[model samples]
Target: MGHRVLAVLLLVAGFVVLAPGTACACSCSDLKPADQMRLSAAVFTGTVVAARQVEGDPAGPTPPIVYTFRPDQVYKGEPVTEVRVASNAESPACGYRFSTGGRYLVFASAEKTGMLQPDPGVPLHTGLCMGNRQVALGTGPVRAGDPVLNGDPISAELVDALGAPKPPSAAPSAPATAPPTAAPASPAASTGGSAPTWIIVAGAVAGAAVVVAAWRLPARRRVRRD
Candidate 1:
């Protein structure tokens, strides 16, 4: 009886040591608004353009949604005109769920990568457990129950720190052209550098009359002297 009890105890101890162990769950002590903003790699306010399932996405609790945003203000990091971020459709995967046409204050990291993601300048991936949160879209005070911001209104310093974002360039205007000039007048329309035939005829008649009068006067004088 004593030998059997010893064998049973030895078997239990060996099994406990050899079996696979469970990994610890992810945990974080929630951070204050300022600390979270400081720790994040990129922070901005933007409007969501669209949401769709990206190509070649990885397996998760739900099909991950890729959100495209047009940035309105940049608090830190690159001032991208457009940014793409991926998060699980369900919040469990730490994905930042985005609604189309909704604006948000996003605190996200671009360190996460995907299998087919293009260059980092194009878009970035954000997930749950990354400490990313949403603040009120406007410049007003942060509302109550905001994940990290709590109820603090936006700081004047933050407003001052916002980078000057270059707006989209307008299309070039078409060149203005002078209306086609009036066609030049023809030679006939001008005097054409020639006198009329009537003037030439009048000059010839006057010269013939003058010559006849001189010949007649000389003959009459000679006859009277003789």
Candidate 2:
């Protein structure tokens, strides 16, 4: 009986140690090309259908730029379950292509195009000019062929194409300062206009009188619990 109990406890301990290895913690850049193929449902190999520049919203920190990808020379490489756009080390304008790893939303785009335009729209497609259909990353719906304007388009895709870059432990900005606070209102302010000394004394006396009256009541007696 002792051995059986010990064995059960050992088994439980082993499972706890090994469980985390099986969990999905994949980041986009962490996955290799082979993994990308295995995981994605569809893939696209096309030039930037549309790219644009945008200002980072000061109200928002570091805004993201978006890109519109249209299928041009569509070769169905392993169904892309995920996508990433990598940025260039030399420049922030053009991004490389990247793929996703195990964790969702992590993307990398590794290849960079040096200022290339999308193939001119064929007669079958007619509407907004090729460059006009960009959307802000956090602003709108994401669907195939939707125009996207990345605030820092190249950087946006580059990070997506590559894995997320190492994060700096702290921002370069000066540390935040505590805002000035007003002094707490005095008792006079809290009581509305000026209150006379007699009124304050009377209030204190009345409160003490009530407390004394309640304490003296016969029901205040406690019954001993044996």
Candidate 3:
């Protein structure tokens, strides 16, 4: 009887430790390298012309803020991406910093942006660095039009300190582009010269004024002679 009780106690303790581990495994899984590179390039360096915040879960849980990334250049690589990172939203501890119209470096392995969400119920926004690469915001607050990079000078030095990351197996290939169309010629091209239209008008006006003055002077001399 005593042996059986001791065995039961040991089994329960093992289950207790293993339960959290299993839950964490389901919750957090790090992203792959290729997906990380593609998303980082799209959001960080890409020019955003427009954006708006999306509200979430008023009666449910936490409200979500969503910002869109519009690409100036073509996204040459991946079809999709996803990531979860800390943000500048209001929390119980540090309060709110970023409201809307802000640019952030999102890190994720999968190619689905909408799937990305903040870690539930954690104060103090934690930055998401995908595939060992972290976001570096500029000095002062992170705002729209701020430059973001995977590894900057300071982060590059840190990478050197920590040893270099292993390079990805293969680089993403750029999409094929069609040949550029030539511009049509305009009819105005044939008349191009240095002299402007306003100069010609000014000269004609000056010539007319000089002729009038010469005619008036001759008439005045004739009247004086008479």
Q: Against the hidden true structure, what lDDT does model 1 obtain?
A: 0.54
| Residue-wise C-alpha lDDT for candidate 3, range 1-226, written one tens digit per residue | 5534432332233222222112211122233434334333222212223323335544532333333332221222232232222332323221122323343333322222222133333221222233222233331222333334434322332222322222212446798898899786543443474456677789999999999999999899999999
Model 3 per-residue lDDT at 144: 35
**Ranking of all predicted structures according to TM-score, beginning with the best and ending with the worst:** 1, 3, 2
Q: What is the TM-score of each candidate against the true structure?
A: 0.46, 0.22, 0.27
Judge candidate 2 at residue 158 and give its lDDT: 28
lDDT on C-alpha atoms for all candidate structures: 0.54, 0.32, 0.34
| Steric collisions counted per model | 4, 46, 6
Worst 10 residues of 3 by lDDT: 19-28
lDDT of prediction 2: 0.32
Q: List the residue pairs that clash in candidate 3.
A: 80-111, 81-110, 81-111, 81-112, 82-110, 82-112
lDDT of 1 by residue, 1-226 (tens): 5534432332233122211122122223444455445545677677788888744424322355678887766666776677777664544223456778777777665443332132224345554444444555653433334433343555554444333433322356899998999988755444475555666678888888889999999999999999
Model 2 TM-score on a 0 to 1 scale: 0.22
Which prediction has the highest lDDT against the true structure? 1
Error of 2 at 143 (Å): 28
Clashes of 2: 46
On the 0 to 100 scale, the lDDT of residue 42 in model 3 is 29
